[model samples]
Target: MSEDLQETGAGDRPGPVTATATPTVTDTTAATGRAYGGADPVPAASTAHVAGAGRALRGAATGGGRARRAMGRGRGRHRRTGRVTATDDRPATFRDVFGVAEYRALFGAAVLSWVGDYFAKVAVAFLVFSNTGSVLLSAIGFAISYLPWVAGGPVLAALAERYPYRRVMIICDVARMVMVGLMALPATPLPVLLLLLLGASLLTPPFQAARSAMVAQLLTGDRYVVGLSFQNMAGQSAQVAGYALGGVVAAIDPHAALVINAATYAASTLLLWRGVRPRPLPVVHTERRSLLRETFDGLGFVFGHRVMRPTAMVVFSVVGIIIVPEGLAAAWAPSFGGGSQVTGLLMAAPPIGAVLGAVVTRMTGPERRLRLLRPLLLAAPLLLVPVLAAPPFAVAFALVLLAAAAVNTVLVPLNGLFVQMLPNAYRARAFGIMQGGIQLTHAVAVLVAGALAERLPVPLVIGAWAVCGLLLMAVSVTTWPSRQVIAEEVARAAELNRAPEPEAPAPMPARPPVPAQPAMPARQPVPAQQVLPVPAQHAASQPVTT
Candidate 1:
């Protein structure tokens, strides 16, 4: 409980973390999936879905400690004996995250890779359109980039668990580089080029998963969250720049764009090889289960765990809801009498909002992030509900931007919480699932919103989508695991992840050995007040439960 509520400010986490690459036995149980025991699933909300989500928004700008406590009071009377002790309330700076040489290497590699991938999309589309002269084939050619992720991203990502993350990243980059190089040859048939494109795309999930999973290893604790914000901001910027550059470069010469993409991969491979240090595999596989089976296990673990499941659901729902506005931007722009330029601006709002949000989230201190987690989770979607009124274009754009920012705000620290609770063995797979879910959710949400727009006003459909998201988040909050449970789980995860790396490696230990902790057994649940430490005065007093 103490560790869970324990604040993480700048410079709090110790040591040079690179990635979880060593093999270790896991203690996770099939029954609980974590050290902490969970309570019942919370039902749908009552009382204005927890006091008119509108009312809660009024205090949105309040100090986190005060706002969180206020929200906590309104919810079930969960005990709060373990006082939160905040360290320095400072936000980690860009220089702080980029100070490490390894992170800087990764930063350059990731940005270049993203830019190359986007450039390839435009190049592929241009090639197909020029050759086949069919818009559908051209679209399909461009969309082939996402097919592998949608189909087998988790399985591919699980491969990263079997080896050092550095190795996985490097090998994937090299393979992509070679394939894209092959694609640059004019002698290659269109079908062959498409096949090569598919092959290259297939490697993306593992490479990305490996990079994402090892992030905590490069930067520890609060710094990791700050790093995440930087990555998000950079990725958004890269997307905008990539597409613009891709348009110009591909228009001038598609083959040249392909060469440039291939060159980026080569550059990325070199950076990873030279700058990133290799480590032993994080988890040793005691038994060799099929990769598909292990992938399912990862899914089951995420969906079955109480802490992870609700957060996952909330995240997916929020993502799906938020995407509706972007998906409908074209349709909605007509309603407010927008010119083509205004429509373009409306379409750009999501990414613009996301970039700005990342910057804001980066500047927030760690304590405030954790304190505001629950509220922002609820607030993100609630901000979108205002679209039902059919506001003017300016108001609509502002609402969308604010809502997107709220989502980014919730995600940064939420990711840190995930890092704290997840054992090293499951990190890569879980991240893969998360990444896939985001992509799939965006696609589905857009399809649904587009379908509904045909029958109803775009604003009404978007508003309804947001309402659903809010209600689902309400369910997540009500069913959220107790602080005691979360605390024990975090402490236990931290302990297991801190285990020293061993020489040689195995794919994965199906279940890691559970580290011994105070009252962590399935049969013995810790009392709320006794979860960890207490104030000197409060330690001597008797406990009360409501």
Candidate 2:
């Protein structure tokens, strides 16, 4: 009678109470308003009995530490972690960009095209210089090729986005191929040759923009980062190979080099046509008007966004500052008692370092990249210090390589983040503006370095530029995003990306819900059913419930 009264009183306490003879997982901790069986919910019989008992006992004394640790482990286990993944700030692999097939083709084409273009440039410059015995004309030839990028890069790039990416890419490749063939014609005039090259340059930015857009479409999340890195690597490789091959061909016969470059373009066209698949065009609005407004909008989009603006600025400053040394390399190298070969080495150093940095980037996991910006940014400038100290050519080359590697490692991931942050509509326009900024920065670096070289010894000028580079790097370090904020943003972006898509509602009988109360007497205990491990096929078919 006393036991019955005690049980009745416990039940009448106006809180959840478990009264079954068999131990039931009645969520007692939740009833207490604060889960006391640890941070995790009380383990049911479905879980390992021993583990549950251990957890329950531990929670009784340790205030949920074990459950919290278990929760943390569960979180970690479910997470897709990697270095240079989409969520990584500085994604370094092609996987970061997503797996868009179009990007792969475009990437391949760009490699061939960039290499051919550079090779042809070097070959043509040498031929012009040799034929006319005028270095100014040679420089003019190179300058004319670049002028189109300055004048029409943004406009053309905008056009790239307006048309279908595949069509634009195909057309550009064909146009370039035709132009290269014309350049190889036996009776081509030098002025006409310059005009042809300029035309090719005029077409390049739009083509590049189309390719860039296609990349976004091809690879969604992390793939974008990976694609960008691959493209960057290809570009760097092209510059190095083109120059080397151009030098070789020029040594043999400039005409042969031009012919080889022309052949390469043809090969590139074929590769692009065959390798990439077609994609449906994005929605277009016919209501748009006013070119200036559109252009300004693109600029605004790029600079107005928080992450994009600072990122672009950092890119512009770092690239501009570093290029000063290379721009003045011709003058500097001879002064340092080495010839044009040394100039080539100086030009190549940073990229070689960049390749190494990229390799290292690929090896590390994505999480490290996110928390690493501060240290990496600071490390970048330190690499240039040896060069600033007037080291030997070998040492200077090494220093330049180190600096290049550091900068590239930072830039690759940042570029990925920038791409992800950009709206789909403004991608090309933004790229165009950024491309224009890059061109302008290059010219500025050259001009400044030239002026500085006139007043200062070449080595001192180089050192000063290196020092400036260090300062700029320091700014980037100081401006690194807060860890907590970055982590939260990354988590949000990942969640949004991986969220379960909504399903179409199933057809149902038109009916209203009817409530019924159950009779509660002579109920038997229900046996716990074991949950079998979910099969992959079944799991895939289960629509994400979010």
Off by over 4 Å in 1: 1-87, 500-546
Query: What does candidate 2's lDDT look like per residue over 1-546, in tens digits?
Result: 111111000000011112332222211111111111122222122112334455556665666777665433322211232111222222335453434555556677778888888878887798789779999999988777678667767766887667777788788878877887788786888877877888777888888788776665565433444455556776888898888888898778776777777787777778777887666556464667565577787888778765567778877877776677678778868766888788887887877877877776666544344344445665665666555567777777777777777777667666655654455577777788888888888998889889988988877777777677778766655554433233233323333333245887999978987878787799655456744456688876664331
Residue 329's lDDT within candidate 1 is 81
Q: Can you write out model 1's per-residue Cα lDDT over 1-546, one digit (the tens) per residue?
A: 323222221122222223553222111111111212333121112221244244456566776666565565444212352122222234667887889899899889999999999999999999999999999999899989998888898988898888889999999999999999999898889999999999999999999889988787788645677789878988888988999899999999999999999999999988988888888878887776888998999999889876677667767877887888888887888899876777777878888888987877776665465555666667878888888998888888898888888887777766665665677889899999988888888888998889999999998998888888988877766666665455455445656767666878766868978888776556656666555555677777954342
For model 2, the superposed segments whose C-alpha errors exceed 4 Å read 1-74, 77-102, 251-253, 290-292, 480-546
The best candidate by TM-score is 1
Tell me the TM-score of each prediction against the true structure. Answer: 0.76, 0.72
Clashes of each: 21, 28
Against the hidden true structure, what lDDT does model 2 obtain?
A: 0.62
Q: lDDT per model, in order?
A: 0.74, 0.62
CA RMSD, predictions in order? 21.7, 20.3
